[model samples]
Target: MDAHHPWNMIPLPDHTDLNLAEIDVFTIDGIFSTPRLDNESELGYSDHHENDLSTPVPSPVPTDTSTTKETWAETTMAPPPLNRRPKARTLRNEDWAPVKDRVLELRKDKRKRLREVKEMILTEFGFEATERQYKWKIDQWNAGKNVRRNEMKAIVRKGQIRTVAEPDKRSLTFELRGEVVPKEKIDRFMKREQVPFDAIYSPSSGAETPADGILDCWTPATRFSVGRTPTPSLSGEALATNEHSFFVHNISSSPALSSITTLATSRPFEGRSPRLLHSPLAVPSSLEPNDVRLRRQLSNLEQSFGEGSEPTLGTLLELCNFLLVHGRYSSAETTARKQLAACRSLYGDGHERTGMTLSMLGQVLMLQGHYEDALGVYQKAGVILKQTSGPKSEPYLRNRIEEGVLFRCLTRDEEALEILRRAEATAQQVFGRTHDVATYAQLRLILPLVELGQFLEVEERAKELKLFYSTVTPTSQSRRIIWDVNHSLGCVLLRTGRLKEAEEIFKSIWRDAVEISGPEHPASLSYLHNIAETLMLCGRFEEAFGKTDTCISSRISVLGLNHPDTQASMRLKDRILARQRMVSRVSHGDIVQSGDVM
Candidate 1:
C-alpha cells in the first residue's frame, strides 16, 4: 500500500487488515458531516434493524461501491454558492434631476406638509426620502433661485441688456428686450432735464410742477440767498417779536404757520424768562451756542433749497450730528427723520447715503433710552449697509459697534458680546488694529466685557487702546474714545478693589467729559456717577455725597427723573448716606470708650 494514499491516512485496529478497495470512504466522510434530523432518524432505523435480536435482518447482495463512492466524492468536493442579501436603495443626484421641477412646484404649495412632499416624491418618482431630506432639497433650490434673481438684478443695475418680458413662473429663462441705453447718456439726459431749486422755490412756482405742493409752505426767497441773516445776540423772544412779528400778529389766519409757531413754542428753554415763554420761537437754551448756529444754518439751507434738495439734506445731517454731540437726542431724532426722508427720495432706500441716515437715526434713538425702537432701527440700518456697502465696510462695522453698544445698554450682554466680538475681529482684519474704526470697536467691547465680569481681558484691551490713543491726533471722536476707554478702566479698577486708583481715573475722565460734551451730556453724567461710586467705595463720604448729588441733579435734568441713570444716582446717594451714618456711629462709640478709659 502506498504510504501517502487516503486509505493509509485512516486509522484501523492493530490486528485488523482491510483491503483498500473495500474500505467505505463515503461512510467515513458521513461520520464527520453535519447531522440533520432526517439523516439521524434514518441512521437510527438502520442501526435498530441490524442490532435487533428477534428480527432477522435480510442480508442484501453486495454491489460494486466504487461508482457510488466516486459520485459521492465528486459531489462533496464542490463548494456551495453564497446566499447574500440585496443592497439597500440609495438616492443620487440624477434621481432627483428628473423630478426636481415637480418637487419645486409641490414646495410652493404652503398647504402641503413636508411628509406629504416626501410621500409624493416616493409615489411619483419612486425616490424614497425623509421629510427632512425633502425640506433640505427644497431649501437648496430656493437658495439657488434667490441667487439667480440677485444676479439678474445686478445685470439690470449695470445697464446691460434689458428684460422685455417677465419670466413665466414655470420658465427658467428670461427674454432679452435689447441693449439698454448707455448709463452715461442717461445721466447726461437727466442732468439736462433736472429742475433748478431756484425755479422750484420761486414765488411764481406752480402747483402743477413736478415738486407738487412740497414747496407751498416755504416762503419765496432770493434765488441764491437765505431769507434772512441769523442774529446770535437776539433772544428767542426778541427774534419772534422784532423780526418775525408777522407770524405772531397773524398766527391765527395761517394754520401751517400757527402749527410751526406751536411746535417751536412747545420746546421752550428751561431757564428762560417767564415773559419770553410766550414767544413762538423759544429754542431750548440747553443747545450749545455752536449748536444754535448750526441749527440756524440748517434752517437757512432748508429755506433756500427746500428740505428735499441735496444741500438742505446735507445741512440737516450735519445738524443731526451736532445735536447728537450736544446730547440733544430729541432734536437729533427729529432732524435725522427729516434727513432720512430726503435721502430716501434723493438717493433711494438702498443707497449708502440712506443707510447712513438710518444709522444716525438709530444712534439718536439709542441715546434717548428707546432701546427696542433703537434695535429695530439699527437692524434696518445694518441690513441696508450690508446690501449697499457690504458687511466689512467701515460704515457697516461702525453700525454694528453701535448696535452692540445698544445691546449693552439694554443689558443683553451675551448678544452684545457676540456682535462686538465679530465686529472687532472684522475691523482689525480689514482696517488694522490701529485704525480708528477698529479702535472704536475695541472701545465698545469694554462695557460688555465689564458686564460679563471679564476683567482681565477688558484691562488688557483697555491698555492697548490707551497706547493707541497716545499716538493719534486728538479730535472730537478721539477724545470721546479716550474718555470711554478710561471710564472702562476705572470701572475695572473699582470692581477689583483698587479704590483710590479708580477714583483718580474716574475724576480725570469726568473732567474731560464735562469739557468735551458739557456737564449735562449722558456720558458726562455717567462719568460723574462713576466718580461718586469710586469715592464712596474709598470712604471719602463728603466728596462722594457732593459728586452723587451733582450726578443726580444732572441726570434728572438730562435723562429725566424716571430714567435708570437718575434712579441709580438716587440709590448711590442712599448708600453713601448709610455709610456715613455707620462711620459716625462708630466714631461716637469710640469717643465714649476713650472717655471711660481716661
Candidate 2:
C-alpha cells in the first residue's frame, strides 16, 4: 500500500507529451502537489515567501509580460478531464437464486411473455438482466430439467423404477369404434399366455405337422394370426435330441423361421438408406409429447398383460399408433418393434397379425426416412398379406397406399404414381369409390401427381375430392381428410408460385387444425410451418422469421430439438435471416449511391 507505488498512484492522462510542471497530481491523502519549478521567482512567487502568512509578496511589475503570460498559459491549461469508467454489472449465482422460482413460475404461465417475466423479476426481486441474458438462463434451466427427466425415464424403462401399481387380475376391455366385445371373450384372450414354439411341435410322428392348427379356428386370420405353417420333418439324429435342442436347431436351420429370427434380433434401421444418407430432412427419434393419462394407461396395460401376450401386442399397437399420430416417430419405431416381437412370439411368422404389424412398422420407418428398410418391411408384409388376406383385402390395399406414399417421399414420382393409381382402383373396386377407404386412397394420389409436375391433374382431383366431402356429412375422419386435401392443394399452389394463395390456404389449415386439435398439436405445428415457408417464399422475412421461430420452439417441446421437422424450421430461419441481410445491404447501397449523386 505504498502511496508512491505505480499500483497505488492515480493513472496518468492519455496525452503523454504534456510537460510535467503543467499537470496537477493529486495524492491518495487528498493533498494536491506539483513538480518543483526552477524559476518560481520569475513567475512572481518565492519558496521563502510561502512561509510568511502576513507578508505581502509584491507581484512582479510587468517585466517581460509576454514571456510571463506564456508560462502562466502553460501552467493554467488543464489536461482533458478523466472519463469515469462505468462499473460492469454481471449476473451472479446469488443474484439469480432469489428470483429463480418466481421467474420459472411466470414462464410456466403461458400468458406471460419473456419481457414481462424479466420485468416482473426486476421489479419484485431486484434481479437485473437484459432480454438475451434472461432467455439464456431460462433455456439453461430447461435443458437441465430435460436431462434429469430423461434420466428418470431411462431408469423407468430399465424396470428399476415402477411408477404404477402391481397388476390386477381384473379383466380389461378395449372399446373399438363404439363396439364392446363380450367380457368373456376379452378375459379369455387376455388370459391366454404365450407357449413355447416347441410345445406345439411333435417329434414322435416324424412327419411334418401344422403347428396350432386348432387354435387358428378360434380367431379370424384377418384380425390376428393364430395359425403357423406346417413344420418340416426332422432327421433321425435330430429326433433323438432333447426338445429344447431340437427347437434351437429348428429356428436356425429352417428357411421359414430365418426371416422371423432375423427380424427379432436385428435392428430394423441398421444401415443408412441410400436416399436419406445426406438428406437434411432425415427423421430421427422424435421425443414424445407429455401425456400423463395415456402414459399411465399404457404402463398399466403393460403390467397387466405381461410381455409377449396377445393383449400386450394389442396394447403395443395402440401405443404405436398414438405415438405416430402425435409425430413421435422415434417412439413409434420403438413401440412398433415391441409389437412385432410379441406378434412373432404369439402368432408366429406369416400370420396376418404379423403382417399387419410389419406394415405399421414400415410406415413408421418410412416416416423416419429409412426408405430401404421400409421397402423391405413392406415387401415382407405384402407377401404375408397376399397369402393370408388376399391382395384385394382392405389391409393389403392400405399397405400398398402407404408404400406409394413412401415412394412419393423418396421423390420416385413415376413409381409412386403407378402404385397409387393401382391401389386407388383396387380400393374403388372393393369398397366403392365413395367409401372412406377408397376416398383416402384417392386423396393420397394428389401428392404424387403434384410431384410428377401434373399440376392440372392434381387440381382436378382435389376439386373432385373437395366436392365429394362437401356433400357428405362431416365427421372427425372426414374433416381430417378434407384438411389433408386442402393441404395438398396448398402444396400445389406453393410449387406453382402462387405464394399469396398458398399462404392463405396454409393459414386456413392452421386455424382449422388449432380448432380441432389445439395449438400445440403436431398437425397445427405442421400447418404453421407451411405458412412460414410460404411467407419466406413471398419475401416477408420478418413475419417468416417469427413464424419459423415459433414453429421450431413448438416442435422442440413436442417432437424434440433434433427432429427433422425442427431441423427444417431452423434451416428456414437461417435462410430468412440471410435474405434479410441481403435486402438490408442492397437498400443501404442504394442510399449511399443516391447520396454520392447528390
Candidate 3:
C-alpha cells in the first residue's frame, strides 16, 4: 500500500509454477533472517513441489524466444510512476518592509480610522494596502508590542517585590500600615488570582484595625484561617518579631511568580493561563474547545439576550468575537449572519454598519474554510462600504484585501494578482510606496507570482524586503519578516536545484524562527519541517530522521495528531525510516542494491 516503497515496482511472481529448487536466497549476516516456508502452501504453490524436492531438479529452459519474452514481461512489473505532485507552498516570511515603521506608528492608537491610516500608508510609503491587510499587520505588531509593554510594566510596577504568598494558604502576611488600602481593590486582585482571601487582618491585638478593615503595608496577600499558626499580637513592638520579619522577606522572595502580576494586570484567566508558558491554542493537541469557561460565557450571553429580546450590536459583536476566539467557527458564523441581518434591518443595506456586518460574516465564513462564500460576502461588503462610506474607507479596503486572499486560495492566480495590484496601487497613491500597506500588497503579490512561476519577480521582492527589514531596529515582527523573505529565497533556490544554499537558508530560518517564536510555535515547527526536507534531499538521512522526529512530536503536540501537517510529518518520518532500512539491508548484503524492499 506504500506507493513510495521500491518493491512496488517489482511485480508479484506467478505462483502457479514457482520452482523451490532454483530460488536464490541470501541471509543478512548477524542482522536479520528471512524465515523459510516449510509448507509449499504458504507460498501458494501446489504440494507437488514438496514431493519432488528430494529428486534433483533441472532448471527449465524456454523453447521459444517470443513466448519466454512474453512470460518475462508478464511476470516482471514496471515500477510505479514517480510522484509528480506539485509541492505544497512553503510558509514564506514575507515582510512589508516598505511601510513597517510608518504603519507601526499609525497603528498605535486603536481608535484610528482605517481609511485615514490606509491613506497615510499610501501617501507616506507609497505602499498600497487594504484595511484588512492593515488589520492583520496591526494584529502582528500589537502582539509583539503588547508583550513588550507588559514586560516593561511588570519591571516598573515592582509589585511582586512588595507581595508574598503563603505556601499552604493563599494569604500573604504584612505589617500594619498608617493608611488603609481599599478593600474593593484588594478583593478584585485576589479574585483574579483565584486566591481564597476573604479579608485582611492584623494578628497583633495592639495594632490599629485600620477603620476600613484593611491592613497596613499589605501587598495583596493577607492571612487566612487555612494556614499553620495564629498570628501573634502587634502590641509591644511586635514589628521586630520573627513573624513580621519573615512575612516581609517572604513577600519579596519569589522571582518565579513575577510573571503572575503581569498576567493578572492584563486579562487574567483568558487564553493562556499565567502558569503556562504559551497559549492553549499554541499548545497544539491539548485544547478542549468546549471548556467550561467558554460554555458559561455562551450560556450567559444567550440568557441575557433572551429569545424575545433582540441583541444589540455590541452584544452580538461580543458574542461573535468570543466564539471566534474559542474556535467555535459554526456558532461564530451563525452569530455573524444574525448580526448582519440585524444590521440590514436596523441600519439599512447601504449603511456603513451593514457593510461592517457583512465583513464580519465573511471573516467567520473564511475561518470555516468556506472560501467561495466568503469571497461573495466580501464582495457585497466591499460594494456597500464603497457606496456608503467611500472606496477610501477602511471597511471597503479590508474587503478588497479579503477578495484577493480568496482568489489566491482558489488558485485563481491571475485574478489574485490583478486584485492585489489594484490594492497596492491604491495604497501607493494614498499612502505612498513606503507605507506598510503598499509593502504588504507587494508581499501578497509574491504569492501569485510564485505560483505563476515568476521566480525572478519573487526573488526581487523577497530580497528587497529582506534587505529593508534588516536595516530597521530588530524586533520579533521584523525578524519574522526577514525570516519569511529568506524563506521565499530558499524556496526559489530549492526550485533552482541549489541544494547547498537552500539548506543553509533553511537552517538559518529554522534557528531564527525557534529563537523568535520558540521551538513549539507552529512557525518554528514548520521551519524545522523544512530543514528535515532539505536534509533528506541532501541524502543526510540520519540528520533528517532526527529533525523529522522532533518536528513530528512538536506538530502532534501543538497541531494535534490528526492535523494534515502532523500526518505529513509522520509520513516523512516513515520515508526516512524506510530509506534507512533499505541502506541497512544493502550494507549487510541482504539485498544486492538499494531500495530492494522485497
Candidate 4:
C-alpha cells in the first residue's frame, strides 16, 4: 500500500457530489504515509515506494480549463501519458558566481552562531574566555585560511610545508589531543578542549570498616546497601488508594535490598516492583498524526495511562522518546526539559539520555523560533553527548543537524555551512556516504546553496540526495527525501524557467506520491497541486482542470472534507479553478460545491 508507488494510483471514493455533509471520511491505514511533520517531507508513510518509476506515470494538473501535459516531458523530448510507462541539467561552477558572495555571507553567519554555541557551552561548563581570546583565535585561523597560492609557492620553495590534498585542504585535521596536557586540554574546553576532572584519588584499596560508610572513591565501584525506594506490596496494595500507590511507583528508584550483595552478587527485588498505574497520554512531539504503528501505539497508550502497570527506565525512556517526537511543539519543549531535569536528577550530569532529552527540547524550541534557548541546549547536548558517544553518536549527530538548521534560520550562512559541512563529513564517516542519514545531511548543505541560488552547487548536492531515492535502495529515508526535496527543487526550476524540467519533476512526484502515500495523503495532494499549477503555467488548460477535479475528489474521500488537509486541498483546488476560468471561458460541466467557492 505504498502511496507513492507509480503503479498504485489510489482510486478516490465514489462521492457523487462535492458537498461536505454527504462526504463520509473514515480512517484507512496505509492510505498514505503521514507526511513527515518536518517541512522537508510530504504527507506519506515512509515505506511507500516513491521512486518506483516504472509504475504508471501521472500527468501534471492543469491550472486553466484546458488539456493536461504529458508527465515528465523535460527529460525526454517525447512526453509520457499519465497512465503510460515513461522514463526520464547543467550549470557550470562559475555560473554559481553570482550567488557566491551571499553564500559566503550565509556561511559566515552560520559560523557566528556556532561561535555563540561554543561560548555558551564554555560558560555552562566554566570554560571562561576574554575578548582577547576571540581576536587571537580568529586572527590566527583566518591568517592560515587566507594564505595565497603564491605565498604557498614561496613557502614550498622554503620547504616549510608539504603538498596539500584537496579534500583536507579546507578542513582542520589533527591528532586526537594525543596527550591530555593541562595547558592543551583544560577545564575551559568551551574555549579549548579540556579534561573534565583533576587527578583521581581513592581510599585504601580494601573493604570498608563497619564504622565507615560504603561510599569511597578509592573503591573501583560503589557498593549497594539496604536502601531502596520501596514499592507497595501488591497483596495489600489494592486497599491503598491510587494516589498512595502512585506515589510508591513514582518514587521507586531508591533501591533497598533485604538480601543484597555489591556488584558481584546482584538479585531481583523481593517481589515484582509494581503494576503500571497508567501509560503516557501525550503523543510524540514531532511525528504527524498518521505515523502508522507509532500513532496506533500512542492511542493504545492513552487508555493505559493512569491504569497500566509500572514500566522500567528503558520503557519510560522509550515512551518519553515517542512523546518527544509527537507532542505539540511547545508542549514537546516543556516535557523534554522536564524529562531531562528528571533524568539529570536520577542519573547525574554526565548521562547521555539527560543530554538527549535536553537536545530534543532544544529542537522543539528552535522550531518554535526560540533561537537563544536552542543554542544553549545544543551546546549542553553537544558537550555532554561527546563524552560517551564521541562526536558521532545519533544524539550528537541530531543535535548538530539542529544546530545547522538553527543557524540557517538566523541567516548565519557561514556557521550553517561550517557546521553542516562538518556534520556531513562526520555523517559520511559515521554512516556510509549513500546512507539515509548522510544524504539528509547533504541536503542540509544544499538548502543553503539553493537559497544562495548557487544552482551548480545545488545540483551537485541534490544529486547525492536524489541518488538515494532514484535507485533501488528506496529506503523510507530516501523516499522521503525524494518526495520533499524534488518538490522543493521544482519550485526553483519553475522560477528559473527550466519549465520543461520543472514540469517533469512535479508530475513525477505527484504521480509517485499518489502511488506511495495514496491520493489522499497530504504530500500527494501537495504534489498534485504543484503539478496542476505547473501545467497552468505552461498553458495546459483542460488537463489542469481535470487534475484539480481529481485532487478535490481524492481529498474529500480520503481526508474527510472537514479535516485541515481537506481544507488545504480545497484552497489549492480553488486556485486551479480560478486559473481555469481565466484561461478558458467554457463552463466545463460545473462540479459545484454547496454554494461554496470552487
Q: Please name the candidate that would achieve the greatest TM-score relative to the true structure.
A: 2
Candidate 2: clashing residue pairs, number: 0
By summed lDDT, the worst window of 10 consecutive residues in model 4 runs over 267-276
The global C-alpha lDDT for each of the candidates, from Candidate 1 onward, is 0.59, 0.59, 0.54, 0.47
For residue 505, give model 2's deviation from the true position in Å: 1.2
> Cα lDDT of model 3 overall?
0.54
Better of 2 and 4 by lDDT: 2
In TM-score terms, candidate 4 sits at: 0.37
TM-score of every candidate: 0.50, 0.51, 0.40, 0.37
Q: Rank order by TM-score, top first?
A: 2, 1, 3, 4
> Native-vs-model 1 lDDT?
0.59
Model 4 misplacement above 4 A:
1-342, 367-373, 392-394, 430-432, 469-475, 507-598
lDDT of 3 by residue, 14-75 (tens): 34665577553443222222323343343334344544434322222222333343464443
- The better-scoring model by lDDT among 2 and 3 is 2
What is candidate 1's lDDT per residue for 30-101, written digit by digit as tens?
233322222113222323233343432222212233335445544444223233555545655545544553
RMSD after CA superposition, every candidate? 31.2, 25.7, 34.3, 36.8
- Pull out the clashing pairs in model 1: none
lDDT of 1 at 401: 94
* Tens-digit lDDT track of model 2 for 401-434: 8988888877798999899899889889888998
